[model samples]
Target: MRETPSTPAPRPIVGMVGAGQLARMGWQAAISLDIGLVCLGSAGDAAARAGAPLMEGSGRDGAALARLAAGSQVLTFEHELVDLAALGRLEAQGVVARPSAAVLSLAADKLRQRRTLDTLTGVEVPAFTPVTSIGELEEFAAAHGWPLVLKARSGGYDGRGVWICDDGRAAGQAFAEAAAAGLELYAEQAIDLAGEAAVLVARSPSGEVAVYPAVSTYQRDGMCRWVTLPASLPDGLDKKIGRLARTLAEETQLEGLMAVELFLTREGGLLVNELALRTHNTGHIHTEAAVTSQFEQHLRAVLDLPLGLTSPVVPAAAMVNIVGPADGSDPATRLAAALAVPGAHVHLYGKGARPGRKLGHVTVCAQTSEEALALAQEAADRLEGNG
Candidate 1:
C-alpha cells in the first residue's frame, strides 16, 4: 500500500496589530489563502467576533504585542494606532515586523511625511509648517492665507485632530487647544474646490509591486463616506497618478500597502494629501472590483509572497460605508433588505451601535460607475435605516 504524502503546513502565520474591520477582512482573505491570522484586540472586536485567532489585549501594550508575536511567523498591522516605538523594540529583539518601524515612520508621522514628500519632484504638498505657538500660526496664515488647516503632527485619525481656521483669533484659539492637548501641530494652506481621490499601491520585500486604479472618494466631515471606481480625472491624469504611485512604491522600497490620498483641485492639479501604510478604507471597494483585494495584497507583500493581480475585474464598483444610524440600531437588523439589492455585497462588522461610527460597508459592481455607486448607496442607506 502506498502511503499518502504528508501535507505541508501553511507558511507565515500572520500576527496583525489590530482587530478592527480591516483585520476582519484580512482574516477572511487569510482563510482563502490557507494562512493563519492572529489579531491583537479584545474579544469584542469585529475580527474576534468573527472567530479570527486573537490575543486579548490593547495594541499599545508592549507586553501584549510581544505575546501576539511569540506564536506568529510575522507581525503586520491593520491600523496606525499601534505603538510605533514598541514595534522598534520588537525588531531589536528579533521579531519580524513588516513595513518596519522605519517605514512606518514615513507614514505614521504626518509632519515627517510632509517633509519627505516635499523633497520629491512631481508631488505637490500643500504649503505647510510646524506650528509651535500662536505666533507661528499667525505667520503661516499671513503667508498662506486665512482658512488654513491645523493638523496634529501625528497620532490623529478620522478627522479628530484637524481644525479649519478662517481668522487670526480662531487660529490662535485653535493653536492654544492643540497646545493644551500636548499635540505637535502643523499649519497647512487649505486647498479649495474639487474632490478627493486615492491610489492604492503595494510592494513586496522581493521588489514586486502592484498599482490599482485610482478611485474617487467622497468625504463628509473629513470622514470618507464612499469611494467609486473610474474616477472623473482629467485627460492624462490617470497615467500620471499611476506613475506617481509606482515611483513612491519603488523609491520608498515599500514592503506593504500604501494608499496615497490626493486632493483633486479645481485648478486641475493633484496634491498629495496623506499616505496610509497599511490596508486602507479607500481599498474596501476592491473587495468586489479587483481581482485581488488590498487585504490579500498586503498580506502577500509583508510575507514576501508573489503578489496578486491588482486589476479591476468589473467595469465599475463602489464601496459605501454604513455609518451608524441616528436611531442607534445595528445593521444586522437591516441585513436582509441590503442583501436584496442586486450586485450588492454587504459586510457588517459585529460592532455596537454608535452615532456616526462605521458599522459596515456595501460594495456593488455594475456596468457603469454611476450604477455601481447608486446601488451601493442604496444598500448602505437601507442598512443605516435611511432607505
Candidate 2:
C-alpha cells in the first residue's frame, strides 16, 4: 500500500471494506473531517496505496474483517463484492451493516434482484427465462428468438459474466459451462433500448433521502465508458426514472448509496435495468463536480448524518473510464499530463493492468457536455498512451 502523507490532524474513524478507488476518494473526503478512514483491502489496491490506513487482507477473511471492524464507529463498503457471510456474522454479533443484510443480498444476486422486482414488486420486466441446462437455453432461444442475452446471476460487472448468443447451440454450450459451476443463468429478450441512465440516491438510517440529477450512461459492450450529468431526456421521462428509483429505495429501506440503472426502450417507456447498493461507477463524476461527492454521501448515510446536496457545482460534467491497453504501462504516469489539462481530474485504481479492466477514470467539468466529453476523451487518450 502507498504510504499516507502526513495528516494535519486526527479524526473520527470510519471503517470501509474493499480499498478500490471509491474508498480512496472517500479518504480524501475524510481528510476534511479529520476522520480516520481505515481500509480493508487486498495487498496493493490502488486506494489502499494512496494512504488510507490499510488492514491488509481479504474482505472474505473473517478474522481479517473482525480485526478491521474492531474499533470503528461505523462500517460501510466501497465495493459490493464483500464476503457477505462474514459481514452477516459480524452483524449477528451486533455490528451495524449499512444498506443491511437483506438489501445487500438483493444487490449481490441478479436472479434474486429480478425476482424481487418481477414477482414481488409487480414491476414489468422483459420476458425472462432461467437456464439450468443447455437444453433449457436451447428451448428458450427457440421461443424467444435469436441474439438473446445470457447473464450470470452473480459476480458480473463491466461486461463480464454476460454473453450475447445468436444460436441455440451457443446458448447451450454457455449454459452448460455456467450450470456446471453452480452459477445461476438467465436469458432475456434483447430489447431495443434507446440508451441507459442511472439515478444515484443516498438514504440515511434516519430515513433522509437526497437524489442526484438523473444521468445518462454510455456503455461499450456492457462496460460503462462515459457518464453524462443530467441526462438529455425530457422532463417527464426524468421524473418517471426518478420515481422508479425512489420506489425501489423506499421498498428496500436502503441506507447509504443506491444507484438505480434504467433502460429507455425504443417505445419511450422506462424499464428497470439493475441496482447497485453501494457507490457506483456511474457516480464517479460526482466526486469533484457535485457539492457533495457520492463518497461522502455514502459515509453520511451510513453514519446517519444529514445527507448533503447532490447539485453539480458546474453546468456539465462527464466521466470517462480508463481501461488498460494490451501492453501494461503505469497508469499513474499519465496523471501528470491529465492534470495539465484545465478542469480535468484522474483517479487511478491500484490494480494489475489487464485488457478491458478499468484502471481508473477521468472526470472533466466544462460549460457544456460536449466540452466535458472532449476533455474526458483527451484525458483517456493520454492515459491509454493514445496521444
Enumerate residue pairs that collide in model 2.
Answer: 2-49, 11-34, 46-350
Residue-level lDDT tens digits of model 1 in 129-187: 99887888888888889899999988887788888888888888888888998999999
Model 2 CA deviation exceeding 4 Å by range: 1-11, 120-122, 180-182
Predicted candidate 2 versus true structure: per-residue lDDT over 1-387, tens digit per residue: 999898666455788887887888888888876677888886578777787788887767878778877878777777667678888888899878787767888878887888787863635666677777677777777787888989998888887888888777777777777777777888887778788889999888888888888889999989999998768786598877767777787888988899988887888877787888888999998987899988888888888888999988999989999998778776667778877777788887777788778889999998888899899988888888775
Per-candidate TM-scores read: 0.96, 0.92
For candidate 1, the lDDT comes to 0.89
Best prediction by lDDT: 1
Q: Alpha-carbon error at 72 in model 2, in Å?
A: 1.5
**Poorest lDDT segment (10 consecutive residues) of candidate 2:** 119-128
What TM-score does candidate 2 get on C-alpha atoms?
0.92
C-alpha lDDT of candidate 2 relative to the true structure? 0.82
Per-candidate RMSD, Å:
1.7, 4.3
Question: Can you give the lDDT of residue 220 in candidate 2?
Answer: 93
lDDT of each: 0.89, 0.82
